[model samples]
Target: MSIKALVAHGSTNGSTAQIAERIGEVLREHGLDTEVRPAAQVGDVAPYDVVVIGGAVYAGRWHRDARRFARRNADQLSRKAVWLFSSGPLDASAAQRSIPPVAGARRAMAHLDAVEHRTFGGCLREGAKGRIARSLITSGRGGDFRDFDSVTAWAERIATQSLGARAEPERGDLRT
Candidate 1:
């Protein structure tokens, strides 16, 4: 059976959503069935064998939609193979070194027993929806800071791990 994966994200101005989509693409390339969707739009987590949740960070907190999704699906998520990611650093720090998850992400990780978590650089561009985003763009502080190579590397690693796990036969199926 093919492993079904879900890449659900909470994004403000679409950069994080694009990252989620990239992750889904990578997983699909590795032969896992993958779907990308907004966290708010996912009503249940039971259909997927693997779940990857990502959120945009603002002021050191995860986006509200991601937090709520984690809370609502806590029980189901804890039973599945789960991963989490955050995108918020406007600089190159994420690519230089591992950026720890924000407090909310940490809490969710503990609550859901997520297998891994990654942090990636954020993007801010012209016409972003918020006043701060607009001001940042005007001040030349906004640009596409996302590291897509990093995103692809992380997703590939996940595919390998998931595929290896699926290759192991279940105890019940290992009859002598």
Candidate 2:
């Protein structure tokens, strides 16, 4: 059976979309079927075996649509394998530590047994934002800080674990 992964992301300046596509590519390379789509375009999470939800973080919070998507599909999602990712912290220094998602949001995510969450460094495009948004980004000392190797490694792990679980049982298989 082919494993299907739904990669959904929300972005303002498009960095999150880039991150999501990178993940989809990695999963596809591992022999899994993957679809990359925007959070708004993902109508139902029920069809996918594994759902990878990602979003841009602004002001220490995930984009509104991403949060709403999770909430709306929480019941169905809680029963399947789900992975969550956030693209934020645009510099290497900030990427070293775990940056928690918006206050209560992390707590809400914790309730899902099959969910795994990750935070990735993102990019800030020059001249793509208004004064306020630009100012906030600048104040945070932004720059592209994504670690491609790390991202690929994480994707590989998820692919391994999820696919392994779905593998057919063999005679005398220890797991069975």
TM-score of each: 0.95, 0.86
**Candidate 2 Cα outliers beyond 4 Å, as residue runs:** 137-140, 168-176
- Badly placed stretches (over 4 Å) of model 1 are 171-176
- lDDT by residue (48-69, candidate 2, tens digit) is 7888888888777787767877
The Cα local distance difference test for each model comes to 0.90, 0.75
**What RMSD does each model have against the real structure?**
3.2, 3.7
RMSD of 1: 3.2
